[model samples]
Target chain A: MKGAEIFVQSLLREGVDTIFGHPGGAILPINDALYDSPIRHILTRHEQGAVHMAEGYARATGRPGVVLVTSGPGGTNVVTGLTNAFMDSTPIVVFTGQVPTPVIGNDAFQEADIVGITRSCTKHNYLVKDVRDLARIIKEAFYIARTGRPGPVLVDIPKDVSMSECEFVYPESVHLRGYKPTIVGHAGQIRRAAEMIAQAQRPVIYAGGGVIHAGASEELRTLAELTVIPVTCTLMGLGGFPGVHELWLGMLGMHGTVAANMAMNDADLVIAIGARFDDRVTGNLEEFCVGAKFIHIDIDPSSIGKNVRVDLPIVGDAKHCLQRLLQELRSIDKDWKAAHADWLAQIAAWQAKYPLRYHQEPEGELLPQFVCEQIYEVTQGEAIITTEVGQHQMWAAQYYHFMRPRQFITSGGLGTMGFGFPAAIGAQVAYPDALVIDIAGDGSFQMTMQELATAVQYDLPVIVAILNNHSLGMVRQWQQFFYGGRYADSSLEVSPDYVKLAEAFGAVGLRATRPEEVRPVLEKAIRLRRPTVIDFVVKTDENVFPMIPAGGSIKDMLLA
Target chain B: MPTANDEIQRHIFGLLVENKVGVLGRITGLFSARGFNIDCLSVAETEDPTVSRITLVTAGDSRILEQVQKQLNKLIDVIKVMDLSEEPHIARELVLIKVNAGAETREEVFRIASIFRGKIVDVTPKTYTLEVTGDEDKIRAVINLLKPLGIREMVRTGTIAIARGQRVL
Candidate 1:
């Protein structure tokens, strides 16, 4: 069998049914093999779009997303996507075409040192020098990508190697001597953590994206309920705990709710499950949870004390740790509910006093928050929400109440603009019948607007709700607060009509200029069950409030 | 030993890694990417042909050093990382120094090299090439003593360390 045939077989062996990629001259052999294979390939408009789509597919389903692209420019374009996935710990395997093995270092046409280029941004990468190593490399790439903390891995295959002949034998298992992930928590550490939790007067369960990645939402919810502890999620962890639960504290970060931030500030113990203390969550590290003892549980050992010091560190899978913790807590005879009543009441008081709020008059211009609320209502909080990075993303997080894990898929760590539309398309590909919506900002949407053709071509019924404010709302908001209202280059005064663009791409387009029209347009888009773009002309100066300035303590939140 | 203050101290990290192309690049790339400085680095294949040993020297506060160790361990190509500085360890570095020693300075250079237990590797009428192996401090002292004798050319291998006990890195 040829090396390209072996590559296809290895993917099949790994249970990869769909791939997101683009074609070019260097990858012609692999493309030829793909033509005869059963694996479905979603050809993206650009290499970046392909990788983002793979991320969306991987996030929606708990499988490693896969991508294939050509050499040089194709390889360079996916670097941002690889970095984005790496930062978020998304599992994606990217295969880039390389110049023939003989000309690898000679700088042949469309050649690149992609493996070296992506060394830091990827979890691991490989340059297959021989056809004999192709199968094993693919196996290792997938293993490295989906295991442990889960991150993007790349495999650059030379063009000649793919064209060369090799015997196809897929490995049954991968044995990486240097790569071993601790799946189960240490028994003694789990016991100590349980004791700490039981003894604390005020405790908050801080969850992050790792919970969703580990499929530990059920375990997390059980532990929280059994201990009667309040739960707060990071932006990436929005749906890990049910949004409508009484114990749920809206996301705790820069734009976090007052109750969640205050609770974090006052807690005596913080049980951080699969959550890193990112700077956005813990502003001014000196003042962040200084009074609290921390118990950090994560699969990545390096992430435990990377940012903030912790009292106890449990290195293992979040699900296994949570399971053991719940068992240990159950063995103890403590009335957690009665002991934490005062703390719960205090949290309730904070929540009641200050909620996530925005103003909209009876006939005022459409607000982005209002549009988000309408999306939530129309989809009944069931849509898979992907967002580009900006004010609209924050609004969606504030307004759309996610009921389950994997429902709120957005670029959290890298905060990549132009991520949502392609990601939504990927999610739609994974679940054809489900409503996958991209709540995008105009500035971010324009970054990857060309993917509209991909969506239309695939007939993916994904809705792009563009919060069309004339300026970059988030940057403008920061400038207003810090730079004495100097907007500078943050304005998008001249922009394309999103509706016309959608129509030109053979997709439906709708416009909602007023608050009343927002719901109707969303309902119509949902009814159409096709690729549709809804242009929501929102308030130009609208800002995401309840924001603690960058590096500011939680006490310094600007509520108005 | 407990640190009296959070002063920056030199640390030696011994790492066993897969002897593959780009593995070294990955390790060095990590340090550069994280804004950490590498004071000295030496790598060579170990007894196991498939594996290589790397001795890296860096200086930082304890907290930052701890992070560096963890980050190094996180790399996929690295099999194991040992902080040789934290344990009783033997470290050595080889230095070859060529001194401009005519008849007048030759005797003094020979005495200095003998005092430092260095060997005369090469000699000419005007130059004496001496080879020395010792810890970083001894090498620094020898270089300092030979500076006034008009050193012509010098090359030094970075430090390589191993734990003194039966434990292997």
Candidate 2:
């Protein structure tokens, strides 16, 4: 068997049904091998789009996303996607073609050291030198990408190695000597955490994307309900628990709701499950949640006490820890609802105070928040929404009350601008019947608008709600509040007619300039069931409120 | 009392990383990219064929050092990192020093080497080469003494350390 055939066979053995990629000179053999294979290949317009699509698929499905691209610029373009996956803990395996072995170090055309470039970002990367080791290396790449705090991995195959011939055998499993991630929490620590929970009068459950990755949403829901604690999710953890529950305090962070931030500040016993206390969420780290004894549970040991030291640290997967914790709480069999009525009432009262608000635009001018609400209404709160970074992402997170895990996808860590549309394409590929929407900003959507062709070619009905504010809305909002309204280089005057651009790409296009036109335009486009874009000319200076000034404490939230 | 200056002490970190290509590049690139200075670094494949051990010496204040620890822990290639600065540990560095000594001074060079427990590894008409292994202070003291004997050239394999007693990396 040839090396390329062996690679295809190994992918089949790993149950890879789909792949997102772009081709170049060095990867011709692999592309040739893919020509007759049963696997579906999504040929994205750019390498970055390919990788982000794979990320979207992985985040939405809890499966490892696969990407294949050619050498040099192909490999470098995927670096941003790799960094984003590393930060968000999405499992993606990227196979980049390298220059033939003979010229790997000679600075040959179409050649670059991708392994070196992605060394800091990837969980583990391999450069296959021997055809005999190719199958095993591929298996290892998949295994490392999907296990133990999931993340991105890369396998760089030199062109010569792919063209070389050898017998193929895919390894059943991998045993990495230096790679052991602690999965189950220590029994002693679980018991201690349970006891603390039982004693606390005021407790808050702060969850992150780790819960969704661990498939522990059910267990987390059980723990939160039984404990009668209000839950607030990080931006990455938006869909880990039901967003419409009575105890849901919305996302907690720099752009988090007034209620969530106030609740976090007032809590006495903070039960942080699967969420790292990142600086964005934990405003003024030293003063964050003062006097709270934390019960930190996470799969990664380094995240246990890396930021805020906890009273009880449980190093284990969220599902396993939550299961054991549920049992511990069951042994007591006591009612917690009666234990913290005042606390819940206090949180509810705060939730009533300025809970994610925006003013009605006079003369029917459009607002981004209103657009998100209309999307929520049209989709009946069930669309698998992916978002690019900035104000639009926050509005979608705030407006759409996600009720299940894997329903909302966004670049939380790296916060890449053009991430949404590609990710939405990936999600659409995963769930063909589900409504997948990319809530994007004009500034961000233009970054990767080339992917519209990919969507049209594949007959995907993915929707792009381009909140065309004619500028970078988030930066402009920051300038208004923080920088004395000296909006420098942030304003991007509307030049491209997005609706016309969508039509040029053989997709349906719509526009809604007035507030009343918003819902009807969304309704009409979503009904078309093909690739569609709704260019919404929104108010340029509409700010996302409940802002915690950088380096400010949670209690110091500014609500407008 | 220790001043603010002492807070920025040199910290020795023991990292167990995958024995893969470009692993060292990731470690060094991180320091250089983040504007952190690496005082010294030494790497070698450990007993396990699939893993490597790296000893990195960096100087930073506590805040900066904490940031380094957090950022390093985020990398996938870096399997484990243990800070050995606050613990009792054993550290050693090996240096090959060539001295510009003739027959008359060669005897004196060998005498000085013997006093420092250094072995004479090479001999030439113009120079006598010596091999010495010790901790940082010990290595620096030997180098200082060898300067008087007309040092020609010298190179050091940076420090490697392990925690003392039952503590393991």
Tell me the whole-model lDDT of each prediction, alpha carbons only.
0.93, 0.90
Clashes of each: 0, 0
Can you tell me which runs of candidate 1 are displaced by over 4 Å? B1-5
Q: List the residue pairs that clash in candidate 1.
A: none
Please state the CAPRI-style docking class of candidate 2: acceptable
Candidate 2 chain A: worst-modelled 10 consecutive residues by lDDT: A301-310
Tally clashes: model 1.
0
TM-score of 2: 0.93
Per-model TM-score, in order, reads: 0.99, 0.93
**Model 2 error, position A398 (Å):** 0.8
Per-residue lDDT of model 1, residues A1-560, tens digit only: 99899999999999999999998988989999999899999999999999999999999998999999999999999999999999999999999999988888898888889999999999999999999999999999999999999999999998988999978888888888889999999999999999999999999999999999999999999998999999999999999999999899899989999999999999999999888899899999988987899999999988987888788999999999999998999999999899999999999999999999888876998888888988998899899999999999999999999999999989999999999999999899999999999999999999998999999999999999999998899999999999999998999999999899999999999999998888888889999999999999999998898999999998789988
